[model samples]
Target: MSKIRKKKIKKTNILLGFICVLLAILLGFILVTSYKSEQKESRHLSEIADDQQSGIEDYEAVKERAKELEEISSEEAEDTEDIKSKNTEDTEKTDTAETEDADKTEDTKDTKDETAAAASGIVCWGDDLINGEESNTYSYMAVLQKLLTDNGYNMTVINKTLQGGGTLSMMKMAGVSDETIQGYITRHQQAANGAQLNVTETGIRDLTEEQTTRNDMDCIPVIFMGYYGGWNHDPAELADQQEQILNTFQNKNQFIVVGTRPMDGSVTSEALDQVLSQKWGEHYISLADVTAQPSSTYEAQQAMAEAILQKLQELNYISKN
Candidate 1:
């Protein structure tokens, strides 16, 4: 071996060692870069999965909320229906009540009308004050009848009158003869028989017989005395006769007693008038109290008629307006 050949082999060995070190460094660098890239990709996939789960949860929550709102809407709709049904029932009940009230009012009116129509009986019994002169067209009684008719009353009036007489003459007019009256007094011996006698005045006898006849008539009587001075009898006897006449129809029928026209300003007339009024109570009517004038003129007669009608209304013999 020569020295020059040994030196060339050493140089070749050093070159091979240098090339191997460079290749190893390059391979390690490449392996490190690949591992870092794979780790980053795994982390990105995990983040994507988390985001998807969150979205699913949010969607389920929204769906539940929507179901609750639907239930609330359904409940509100049912409440509205209930309110409408209750309103309809209330309206029906109100209408029914109104109809019933109308029916009752109509029935009451009908009953009142029938009751008004049923009052129809009246009688006027008196002397010239009620009967008037035979020629007089506007008699007080006639005027009263006209007024009652005009005011829509169904009334029937029967007039019984004696022009110039007291109780005894009135009995004669009612079909009782003087002999029949005497027979009654004779049979009863000062106590007048109710069946056999019909009488008053002369003051000698009771008037039970005359009263029986009036009751048979079934009518209201209006008696007017003080015209003939009790047919020439004693004042005490006349007073007794007057009392008996009044007692005859006291409770049997509602009768009227009229004050006489002032006859020469006699005290007996005044006394008789007072006694009659005291006995008759509210049934007594005084023409002087109504109008100070005698009922000779048409106007005075009409005024008296109006007063009498008003008294009748007060007595409930007729309706007052």
Candidate 2:
């Protein structure tokens, strides 16, 4: 063995040893760096998981709020609908009430107008009703006037009686004659024609003068209260007068003819009732066989007026109000 070769071998061994040490140190450093990087990655992943959980909680809270808002909105809409429906119904009811009130007011006004017309001018007539103080005559006139006023009719009553208070049969009184009857009828006709008179006549006008006077005042309305004593003897004239008076006056005048008094059941009022019924029809002619004279003249007139007023009411000439 050579000394130079031995020394070279030792140097090579030392160099090899240094190289192995360097390699071991490098491997150790690399391992430590890799471990540190892996730990940091694990921490970052945990942070991300926490953030995701928080996000899920926030999303759930938002869903609950949205549901609450929807419920509140639905309730508000329902309340508004109900209020509108009630308002509409109230408006309709108010309109209907207003319309009914207006109609009632109009009807009231119309009734007032009719009453005013009726009150302005009206005429009424009765025979024994206006004449004597001996019976209920004056009292009956007062009652008739009161009734006329209440019914909205202003009326004037005319009576034809001699100076002496007498019954409706005054024409046949002891001192009276046909000429006197004619004069009486003429005077009555003239009185009725007067402007102040509303034109109503009582008692039969059978005399020639009476006929002429009645014809002269043809424009005036009349009412005949009693039958003529000569009417039974002259059926033709009686019928002619009946037809003339009925046809002439028509809706304008009224005639009520009382037949001869029933003396001990000898006379029946049927004949007079039939004639009147045929002349005025069922609605206008009221047939009544008057019993003994009323206690007063006022009662008789009231009864006659009542009958006429009832007829007028049936005809709708006056309203219920």
Candidate 3:
């Protein structure tokens, strides 16, 4: 119980204290390293959020464009209503020369103005661009038809691909029991690589002739939307034939020609580079470009449609001449 035993106990206490200090230092180092790593992760997340904010801005730009188009469309609708009222009043008057002259003037301003008609809206033509309930081509047509209707064009958009009307739906309509109708369907099926047409060639030729005449009547400008390649045909050759068909309209002032190649990677195989590279892909109008992979919901389609409407407004189809 003397001085030597007391000194040994003091030495033991000092060694224990040294070990505890080293342990505390190691624990503090671990905690600091973990905190720094978490701070780095938080900074990285902040950067990601900033990038998403930029994307939102781009999307919002599209939205703003849609809103502008809605405003323009509303104004056009009001103008259309006023014009209809004026026209109604004119119709009630006598068929005198003054009335006729007034009518002519009005027509010149509205229907007879070739430049205005051509610039204001598009007339789309395809086998079923107007009325094939089952055709995929009609899906986009419905969208376009809705656009035209929304913008104040109130006409029944024709679907020339039906029976007794075209090669596909030739015999589906009434009183068309010509045996040649069956023959036409057979030929068309063979040409279409086993795809049957419900229409007869005679009917199609007749409809084509009728449409040709109507194109001259200044009723509505027509745009024939045909596939570039079908049944092993060359796109360039088809484009040429389409050009010829369009020329038959006589009054081609209100017509536009557009050819869409299938987007199933067949455009390259079918040698449609001329159609694709030159006139097809411009203005983002090709169905392939906009609809390769559609968004899952109507909301997305509506958003995309709105974006397209904005782009069209920018083109100024409704601007005063």
Candidate scoring better on TM-score of 1 and 2: 1
The candidate 3 region of ten consecutive residues with least summed lDDT is: 166-175
Candidate 2 residue lDDT tens string, 54-156: 8889888898899999999999999999898889888988988999999997786666456434432322222343444543435433554556568765454
Q: How does model 2 score by TM-score? A: 0.36
Question: What tens digits encode model 3's per-residue C-alpha lDDT throughout 187-234?
Answer: 446667756532332233434444433323232333333331222344
Model 1 misplaced stretches (Cα beyond 4 Å)? 1-120, 129-136, 174-216, 231-253, 261-265, 268-270, 319-321
In model 2, where do residues sit more than 4 Å from their true spots?
1-126, 133-142, 158-222, 233-239, 243-267, 287-298, 316-321
What is the lDDT for 53 in model 1? Answer: 89
Q: For model 1, how does the per-residue alpha-carbon lDDT over 171-255 read when each residue is reduced to its tens digit?
A: 4445455774455345443443344332233333333454325432444444555554433333333344444454444233355
RMSD of 1: 14.6
Error of 2 at 12 (Å): 99
Model 3, position 22, has a per-residue lDDT of 90
Clashes of each: 0, 6, 14
